[model samples]
Target: MSVLYALAGLLIIAAVVSLVLSLLGVIVVGALRILPVVFVVLAAVFFLSGGRIDVHLPDKWRRK
Candidate 1:
C-alpha cells in the first residue's frame, strides 16, 4: 500500500543519513587521536634541535 512505500522510503533515508554521520564521526575521532602523536613528534624535534626557538637563516640571508 501507499503507507508501506512511504515507510520504506523513510527507512532508506534514515539509513543513508546514519551512514554519513558514522563516517564523519570516525574521521573526526581518528584525527583527534593523532593530534597527541603529532604534538609529541614536534616536541621531540624542538628538543633535538636545542632549546632555542629561533630559526637558522640560510647563507643568502646572512650578512657577510
Candidate 2:
C-alpha cells in the first residue's frame, strides 16, 4: 500500500511536469510559427507605404 501511494505521487508529479512542459512547448512553437507571418506582414506594410513610416519608441526602449 505504501508503494502504491508513492507510485501515485510520482505519477501526479510527472503529469504536472509534463503539462507545464507541454504548455511552454506550445507557446514556443506558436511564437516560432507566427514569427514568419508577422515579418511578412510588417514587410508588406513597409513596402506598401513606400518606406515612409516613422516608428516611435519610448525613451527606455530607445536606450536599448
* Clash numbers, per candidate: 0, 0
lDDT of 2 by residue, 1-64 (tens): 9999999999999999999999999999999999999999999999998887688888887653
Residue 26, candidate 1: how far off, in angstroms? 0.6
Q: Candidate 1 clashing pairs?
A: none
| Best-matching candidate per TM-score | 1
lDDT of 2 at 58: 80
Compared with the true structure, the alpha-carbon lDDT of candidate 1 equals: 0.95
lDDT of 1 by residue, 1-64 (tens): 9999999999999999999999999999999999999999999998998867778889998888
List residue ranges in candidate 1 displaced over 4 A.
Answer: 42-64
User: What TM-scores do the predictions have?
Assistant: 0.61, 0.57
lDDT of each: 0.95, 0.95
Given candidate 1, what's the lDDT at residue 48?
Answer: 93
RMSD of each: 5.3, 6.8
Which regions in candidate 2 have their CA more than 4 angstroms from the true location?
41-64
